[model samples]
Target: MAKRPGLGRGLDALLSSAGKKQEGEEAERDLKQVPIEQIRRGKYQPRIHIRPEALQELADSIRAQGLVQPVVLRPVDDGYELIAGERRWRAAQMAGLHEIPAVIRDIPDQAAAAMALIENIQREDLNAMEEAQAIHRLIEEFGLTHQQAAEAVGRSRTAVSNLLRLLDLEEAVKAMVDEGQLEMGHARALLALKGEQQVEAARQVVKKALSVRQTEALVKRLQAGADKPGKKPAAARNPDVLRLEEDLSERIGAPVRIDYDRRGKGRLVIEYNSLDELDGILERIR
Candidate 1:
């Protein structure tokens, strides 16, 4: 079998070994021409939409150059269930293809979902909301963790966590993210706000078409004004902040203070017990 263009190394390795049977069966990923009507949508498919323009462009390509890659499938009772290449299947249908080439596999349900998620994620086809929901499915529906899912999809744990954070947005706010009216940064900044303030802030963000930096500023300004008098500020416990302090303290061989308000107004104070420690800290910073 040939490696498809634009397919990442991780997914390439996965698909290359996808259909070889475990112990019970000797089934291989033998390419077969399957009737389009017999193929059903993947049970674990998280991708909800393939843009019409993109599909049409794909269809045109399929018409002119033929489907360069065969869709992957697993056998069902009467037909095959799609494992990957749903976009190709949809585009082939658009190109008026009655039957398409496929490779039949006999993998289990969890593997099916993992492949689907990995493919979409690697291809960058899913929108932010869809991607986050898919990652959530990997953790919740498919019994993987943020760490495991991160490893599976070739992303950092922090990246997966950030993506998952988009799900915490209000339904309407999430919808805006889905439609690309708001980006992940915008959505993330909004997470700091809550209730009607959150909703109204989202509205203003959309109305003003604010940049992410501007959105963050808006959140900060709102938070500053919203604080009541005599309310004790919560200590900043951002992991990044703590991590930085730890790193600096280790370098300087002294205690480090990362002083910041809840509003992120602050300074870094490195406490050196000796002149040698102070010189070391300054050298490290340099």
Candidate 2:
């Protein structure tokens, strides 16, 4: 076993000893330096794709100051297997190092997977979809429920649930989120629609570079305008009056529009379908 650098305080804590140990046995595993080829990739990599540019940057750093923290690994038939720090392992190879530092732990499969996912989230290396899939796995494969998953990841139940809902978005929209074209806010707003409508809204969000607020307004207008299916509401010069039209339409069960000119004046127009509906509005108002 060879001495290795500490992983600052936070990541070191994430890897603290956790399994049953014999009486009087050492709880901490000794850090070791092992041949890079002998260390196999982990059972599952939460981050499937590593950006070459980022790996090269880390490699350059390793070449200069060396790997600040050793990768965590476990024993396998051939040699050792990665438990965490896939990025560091890949970068070391890019740095053309023959052997890298490691700490070998005997972690249970479920716990090992959880550790990998948690480390990736901490590094902000996982995209939204990858995060969701990892969380889903911790629930399904490990028989963990919502509360358990939340606790495992140190996130609020609501945050976890909201992130899971992102999976419900159309794959196209999700791809946008994963690729960083549309952020979580945009995905959340797009959730207001469904099927092709939601997908189209996501496209508009990216194409127009609309703010979250603007996207919400667009969704509302689209939904409210769906009564006539394809009819476009005429533009109202006064936005304040336009909002009034929406409010009146919702309140009165009819399409309403307000037209206004220069100085805060307008005509409120309400359309009614049947005589009975007209009578209903008259009775409600009077």
Candidate 3:
């Protein structure tokens, strides 16, 4: 047969050379794979929150792919300690893998925790509460300042500050986010309230589908009540309370209030912008 112009000696020679080089590299390749049991869970894992649904999805992926990448770990007193890939390891166990691949390295506990936290944050794999907890752990456990932790996570100080503030929200509201019923915006809106008011506002937010601005307006209304004379302690009132006359005022759609005397005895003044609100209050009392 006649030699093909493109597929003759030159092409054959090039393919043979490339194949030999690949084989040589493969022969030199060294990857140490360890058993699943040999690698234990890390003592300082960064992930504070793991959604059960997410874990189930990870388990499914593990079943399909059989762990494509080895988990990173360090040698410990027991066997090996995981430095990262905790979720993968957990899912692998759920997937019933006999042995998982892991790469062992020597690193300090603090460094390992920081690495794990930074990895998760960069991946955006953590929820708001978990992110806040991670940042808090970096500050509390690792002795890092808020600014330092913010820098470590590649977030602005205000962003970190605001996220941490969410931690102060009612647990019910936090559960809402955990259950994926509410977003951070909703939580932020509720955070503007205090104590039971936060829970109440959260309920209203969900029930009324209130926008953030509307929620904020409700919060301001509640705050204005606190600012009114005789509504709050007499010690805290400003001159504006007097300028407004009556213990409280009601503009269109404004909140109604009833102020009592400091001695706990006085006329019960009811201020309402509309007849509907007046009737609504009366109906509730009756």
Candidate 4:
């Protein structure tokens, strides 16, 4: 497949190039002055939380230095819809600006949605739940296959599948993930249970501040109890080994498992769902 233009560029370049045009076989970004009041929040924006203090800080910066980067917008029936830089738009409004600098593009709905999702992913702005919801929206609303959606966001198919799996989480548990109460690994482990069991396990995980490894163990115990009537509980792992697993998992951004014995001979394992994630883990180790 041919590589898409501006896919590898960082957020700023992507935002600028979102409105790129070809004139005599040369491409250039054109900036415009758009009325602040006429711009509307984008339908595909992935970020759900914008901190008040951070918004104020950006507003202050705009008030002093002006908006250094222009926002990306596309034409809509009522007015221009924001394609990227919702933060800058909100801050410009907070700074009492009548007009904001913007790059106007005439793109279809799928293009706009993909651009919005790409911008947030590049910026690392969306939490796991928000990102999953955004990816799910992109796939469902546009009828894009997992591979197509993965290509749109520059993610592996496995990575995209894992994110979509997060959506299967019960709404209350999903809220916890969205609110930063649970990490991705914790949520993934909780997926082993269903209904009230899953929700209750999530609460217990949060209330006790359990690590990912511990959360997995909790899920296992719960599953065992529900599945087997008289099965013996597994022996507890050494606390030190458990801590090491948690620490390694935290450092590598993937699940880690360790096996230990009386002779101090054991194995260490790190689990990754996709090649991209495996690459990330390897990089972190190096």
| Best-performing candidate as measured by TM-score | 1
TM-score of 1: 0.72
For model 2, give the 10-residue run with minimal summed lDDT.
1-10
Winner on lDDT between 1 and 3 is 1
RMSD of each: 10.8, 13.4, 19.7, 6.5
Clashes of 2: 0
Q: Report the C-alpha lDDT of model 1 over 32-97, residue by residue, as the tens digit.
A: 899999999998888886789999999999988888899988889988999889899999999999
Question: How do all models score by TM-score?
Answer: 0.72, 0.69, 0.61, 0.69
Q: Write the per-residue lDDT of candidate 3 for residues 45-135, one digit (tens) a residue.
A: 7566677888899899989978887787777887888877888888898898878877655555555666666667665777787777777
lDDT for 9 in candidate 1 is 41
After superposition of all CA atoms, the RMSD between model 3 and the true structure is 19.7
If both were scored by lDDT, which would come out higher, candidate 1 or candidate 4? 4
Better of 1 and 2 by lDDT: 1
lDDT per prediction?
0.75, 0.71, 0.64, 0.78
lDDT tens digits by residue: candidate 4, 15-49: 35544533332322468888998999999888898
In model 3, which regions exceed 4 Å deviation? 1-31, 207-211, 226-286
Give the lDDT of residue 268 in candidate 4.
93
lDDT of 4: 0.78
